[model samples]
Target: MTVISVHVPKTGGSSFLDILRKNYGAKLLVDYGLEATTALAAMTSGEHEIVHGHFVADKYVDVQGARYITWLRDPIQRLFSHYQFWQRNKFPRSPFWRQQYYNNFTFEEFAFSPAVRNEQARYLGGMDIKTFSCIGITEFFVESMELFSKSLGMDIELDNLPQHRVNTLSKKGYELDDKGLRAALYEFHSLDYQLYIQGLEVFKSQYSQVSGCLDTRFWDLQKSSQKSFPPQFSLQKLLAEKQVSNVIGTYYYGDGWPINMWDTFRRDVVDEYLDEVRSDGFNTIILLFPMSLFKLKSSNQKAHEIFYNDLVFLLDKIRDKGLNFMFRLGYSWDGFPLSGDRGRVAFSVLCEGSSKDEFIEEARQLYLIAETYSEFLYGFITWEDLLMFPCNRAPKASEPMRIQLATELGFTGNSGAIPERDSGEFLGYLEFLDIKFTDLFMDLAVAFPRLSAEVRVDTTPYNDSDGGEHHYVHHRQFVETDCDVIGTYFATYMLPEKPTLNDMKRILSFVHRQLQVSDPSKKIFIDQLLLVIDESIGKGYSTISEKVIDAFVKWFPEWLDANSIGYATWAFCDYVWDVIFNGTFRYGPLGWEFGGNTMLVESAETRYVQMESGAWLRGGRILHFEPWPQRGCIQIELEVDDACSITVELSDSYTVELDKRDMSQVSSGKRQVITTEFEIVPEYLKILINGGAAKIYRVGLGKEISSCGGRDLNMNHRVTSRLIRELNNNYGGNC
Candidate 1:
């Protein structure tokens, strides 16, 4: 059998040929620019093993028992490289270059030229993608080689092959100059783009089929070869730490223009806050990139450039701060209208009407953006509340709007007779939406397997202490979607009283069991752990002074280590600060600030408590606490700045500071007043000042409130009663 290599120009064909030659040696039958069909016909008996050349698939159709192989590339990049090559080499002797047509043509003109448009597809002679024994992608050449070598039943030395990044045009700063031309070229080569997309699908399918034949070490080698931006904290170093407590991080929330936020972001404030985060022992930050924002500028070169530059800037800064970054696509909490942009309206309309192809295409564009930045990306979370369907009611639409959305979703029935909420048709519509989202999630996971792509759902039912029914539909969707990570957001506390460290573990254990049964492959995680210091419940309630933060800090790491799931605080900063500082994200009833929840209790002070002697302690601030039932003693932790005499005292009484020289004995470099009995117990404790400045880490209140695993406490009765009444009123059930 003859092995035919169809060498598509500028698609790593030259590099591939070098590998082919190394393997086939004298048995390789080369055409060397001669008519490939003629060369094949002229090949002697020994040369029958391999007949490789740059020829269309048709040229080899009659060659008896020939197996064809080829490599394809991104059409736009390939075209740009082709143009740049001619400009650089003057094609040496090509008739077109000799005529100066290549020299005179602009890239835009060259891109759409009849000679090269859709060149990859043309080279294949419109043959079916499956016609080839093997197809590879130039962009992922190493991975392609592994598959190709396996198919050929040979050991291809991939490491020995030199990298081929030939004739790359002025793409480095193309956006700065002739920005519109890139968009023009993209439009001009839409056929090539579609062909490339099809080629990727083909290549991916082939790779999956032969992947089991690959050596485990060979897969590792491929991973080592993947391009990575230099990280402030290398993934190797971060992964080596193996401390579950380090995983406690928060999604950034505040002050940027959410609509293209990077355009006018406050990097200095973020830098300061991130400095606080690092010092506080957090390791990751999540950024939101809206699909509509990217799609709205699909053809706008300037917008694309701005978005790219801003994203790069933010990512680099995050790296500089030694914080890992994850991103969620589809919606930016910024003021981008849900239906304002054409893409959003298109997706929303399509989703409502169930236009699968259009919605998938929209999702494809979004993932393409992810692919571009996959090097810096750590993971992906689905859009906030995307899985919360039926919960989020679509806006009331005018007759025209309803018709438009209905028409877009491909509704064929009478528009005026659209199914009502309680109707079977409407339920079917919801199910369709669920399935589409699942498909979208699975596609991203497959397309970008390197990144941790997953869905984060509201797992409120699983964490609830009320013994309510779980969101069965939501759970089913997540399980069927098969996301890489199953992230949960306990918007409100699952338990009525503050969940103990043990309670948190129990909650997560139940969740893990559920996910393991559904999809054992998915990594379970807690995306949002609410940090509520003091919450009120109607007429009667309970307050746990500072133990909320304490219990979480103390027990969370153990929970993470035991279950091997990641955890992040609800937010790093207050939600209201965005409205106050940036005046963005100002939607009433939907505003984040309206519900106050964040890790940062006060403006700049992060609630970081050091775990020492089985207690979480915080330093450097005035202390505030409310005795749940009665007054109690305090345990104070202080870090002094300098050698100075001082007095430590509560508002009701005082205690003289210890010798400054004795501070040397304090481990972790902080002085402590462990279980210091307060003579007069006040309703609210206060740390009165004296001489030297001290960082007050913690003022642990004793005898405030106690419970049985956060159930049947002072606040639990009030909350349980209210919740029972609410549930009965809503669903007409007895408690």
Candidate 2:
């Protein structure tokens, strides 16, 4: 029982194919390209319930008891759409002659071309119009599909049979307003116009005969299938039965920072770093590795070996520090060119379509390495490195990628048809990438059971040919991966400018909901919690004030605890390359000294001052100016009792007092901001905090005074690290 569907170009066949696929599933064979006929000849009857693609009707006429079907459109409109589609999308499989004709000829020239004059009729070939079991009119696509479904006893629901539009043109049709051109096109496509009219007549006749038949078949199929279908696996139930370990983690790239840290591999530095992280109450450490380190290129072989050894050493050190470790196996930018030729080679390989195999093989090697230290290994994470190109490129499917995608979409024959950007098929292409990514994760998960699959949280916006835009978020990876944990990044772009506590909460809540919608059972881990954003480091980042930083540190952890979610700072320590602002107090309290009755209280969060009425905290080197020096003002954030007053003195030249009138009520205490002027200097600036009983949280200096406090550019890292540590102590459970 073979159904041959001849999918003539620009005849609404692509959309129709989706419905057929849903109805027939694996039984539908997409026979595309010139080789389709030969491929079909080799297949036996009943092997495929439906054979659909771009082949002439006569090609399948010999099939025993086969039913032929096709859709036809207005010849002039179809020609115009086909031309527009070709202009937008490159079809490598298109015949060279056809490509040349379309590339060189005008719309009028193409419409009058003899080779494509009667495309619809030519596709039907020697087959008679009345011979088609079902001739669908593209104009009435929904009704035609319904009729075709009923004629074949396919049980397709009428309500579900919506018209699927693909490769749509901006213009509705050829310039029919040009009467002379329209008349010329109509005359040239007389045979196609006649074929389309005849097809429409056949469609109307079939639809009339079946329109009265109650659509009970679909309901009947649904009822029977429901009984036979197996129960779906419930992730929620699995999660309810198991205890999810809360992860309080930070990413470690070693002392060299960012790229090629293994190059300067120092056991003492890493050991001390891991010890500091462990002492700070971090239970987990995610090691960041550049993909370039694992490339099999001869030039990088020695570096690869060294990296492997360094990784093992770090694992041993992490185990000694009693910290759990996870591997993040792909950071594409290793500061290429500036870093060295090694990064350049790796970047090139990642961009190439042929390097997918190498990428997978390298990942397998990483798994092997982790397997050796499984005692400390929590799982592996992929850092937006699943695709050939980095996320910034907005990569399209290359020819090889499309060929693989053809197989993924269940196409049986090679087809050179590339989907137009923003078309439904193009969306499918993005989904196909997600599937490939999940497949890779699944492969690794088999060996390491506790994998965390990272979801691409950023939505890609695309404008259709009609000047309409839509955004797409890839969630297929979250939905398909069997891993128990899902990973995502929280960056500045996700928040509003000068965000408040409510804004951060709203954004995080939205992200969480989006992931939960995909799969409710999987626990989410904020693998890269980007607390401090530098606009100069990355594009489209928003700056936050010290007040926002203070609020985030206090509230974000509590929110995570209430929700049973976990997170890791993106950069536990500042990177050498200054790619991102540091997210830790790694440098400690560098240049400050306490005096009088002021007592410095040090904890896992931060080092702050507890002062008495006569206490004073003075610092000769309160702020350092690098590269050059300039005049500026100093701002400080402090908390005190309602009646308390604090005086800020800068080099004994300027002074400001913050009293109960200046303070605002907050959850912690009455908070106040104090700002004072300073003079230009080539050395560190001096400042003093004296007078009333108060607690100082932050001190900062900058050229101008705004509402925002200007702390050390890296102080946000201290706030971030402190919050993470606090979260870990309060909620992190043993895995």
Off by over 4 Å in 1: 1-246, 254-264, 296-304, 337-377, 383-391, 395-407, 410-431, 442-449, 453-470, 473-484, 493-507, 536-549, 580-735
Error of 2 at 676 (Å): 32
Q: Judge candidate 1 against the unseen true structure and give its global Cα lDDT, from 0 to 1.
A: 0.49
For model 2, the superposed segments whose C-alpha errors exceed 4 Å read: 1-244, 297-300, 335-354, 381-383, 388-391, 394-429, 442-450, 459-471, 475-477, 533-539, 562-565, 578-721, 730-735
lDDT of each: 0.49, 0.58
TM-score of 1: 0.42
Tell me the lDDT of model 2 at 253: 66
Q: Which ten residues in a row have the lowest lDDT in candidate 1?
A: 577-586
Per-residue CA lDDT of model 1 for 143-258, tens digit only, reads 78888889988678767656443223212512313436545554566566656666655675577566622223222222221111111123223334543233455666433323
**Which candidate should be chosen as best, given TM-score against the real structure?**
2
Query: By lDDT, who's the top model here?
Result: 2
- In candidate 1 the C-alpha lDDT for residue 589 amounts to 13
Task: Provide C-alpha RMSD values for all models, in order.
Answer: 23.0, 23.2
